[model samples]
Target: MSLAPSGFLNLGAQNLEYRMIGPVPEHAPTIVMLHEGLGSAALWGDFPDRLQAATGAGVFVYSRAGYGASTAVKLPRPLDYMHVEALEVLPKLLEWIDFRRGLLVGHSDGASIAAIYAGGVQDHRVLGLALIAPHFIVEDVSVASIAAIKTAYETTDLRSKLARWHKDIDTAFYGWNGAWLDPKFRNWDISEYLTYIRVPVAILQGVNDEYGTIRQVEIAREECYCPVDVMEIANAGHSPHREAPETTLDAISEFANAVLRDEGFRAA
Candidate 1:
């Protein structure tokens, strides 16, 4: 499928890169995608198109500041950076897009940001969340894997590979890497926000995810009062969307279709 035209969105001091895919009918809801820590709008490849085809919902994706062609940020990002993005940037994005109501498709760090927004923000337009490989709380395995990635970025060809997608590779790498590796970040947890999320949540996780364990899924199920569905795909690692696209797409499509059928949420 051909890609839609791309553009830069100005949100205060930040300029975020965004891409819209599929046909956005006058009344249908849009799927706003949030990339991972090291991911960009380009890195998402054609998954958005596949999603659009599967669910018949317009797909919108954006690269946060410091990633892709968006604005660059300073290194050694704050421990509350994700919170800032969730509370500050996301709201601006929705407004810029003129979002009526839709589902949030977030991955890894992006998922955490989405969760925080769904719970913290009073906007009832957000209908549901499709969280992929989310981390509600810090874990030893997560820290160890992040440390290994830091070593790889410093010694291996990882930086060069990532440079193709990001304008300021260092800002993208260090901004995310440094924050997660900081000792003070160990206490970082968004489980408290789960109690506030009233929409349906579809959690798609990989059984072999190197960064996090099933504890993240357990936390969501235990904390959320909404109907939470979990999909643990085998043989997939960190990114189930990239590793097993068909399964991931099917799960997301099914969930979105169900949401579309809800008469309570009319088309915007």
Candidate 2:
């Protein structure tokens, strides 16, 4: 466990604790794992370790503001939290971590952030990308499933399960669910930005994903001009890495190896 000294990261007017794993000074490319909407670094469990072991790449996993070990926002999150995440917060995180290039393995909302970040880059450090159950635009299935999740949160044992992972589950849940469910959010799309990515990409989408459609990954591939290999894991849910860890990590291992090979740095 090569976890870094966890500490607060000052990002503009906000601060959140960031955790790092693996070797320092970047002897190898890092794969940053961005958590799901309601997820924190703690929720990632052992996936990061598996990825590190397989790829020999140090992993950076952190909870964003208002989730996990990070501090909650003093005020209400704006309706466009995705934009806030992509434009304002993520860049600061990259700078704070002292990395110039690497892979981004994002889940759910974190995937969206990675897309936007890579798309926005000039001389970007992103060597490759892996999006797990990412969403570029909301799909009806997503809206429906999220609505159902909300129902489960109130009426079933889901909240208790979530509470075990999140100290303020409401902050984590509402911050993600409310913004996506909001009608105005339907118009959101990052298709235009994906074209800017020069790195290879791998998109993992479940055929039965709870909150998205296959077309989302298709559009990302098309717009980015890189046909990222899409793996539609049969019977997998929105969290394929959780549902099918071995399958998910196998794809990730392939991408990381390819990237390192392209850069002439074989995995040790």
Clashing pairs for model 1 are none
* Clash totals for all candidate models: 0, 1
Q: After superposition, how far is residue 123 of candidate 2 from its true place, in Å?
A: 4.7
The alpha-carbon deviation from the true structure for residue 187 of candidate 2, after best TM-score superposition, in angstroms, is 1.1
* Alpha-carbon lDDT of model 1: 0.89
lDDT of 2 by residue, 104-132 (tens): 89999899888887887643677888999
Candidate 2 Cα lDDT to native:
0.80
Residues 23-124 of candidate 1: C-alpha lDDT, one tens digit per residue? 552346789999999999989999998888777777899999999999988777889999999998899888877787779999999999999999899578
Per-model TM-score, in order, reads 0.95, 0.93
Worst 10 residues of 2 by lDDT: 1-10
RMSD of each: 2.8, 2.2
Alpha carbon deviation, residue 2, candidate 2 (Å): 12
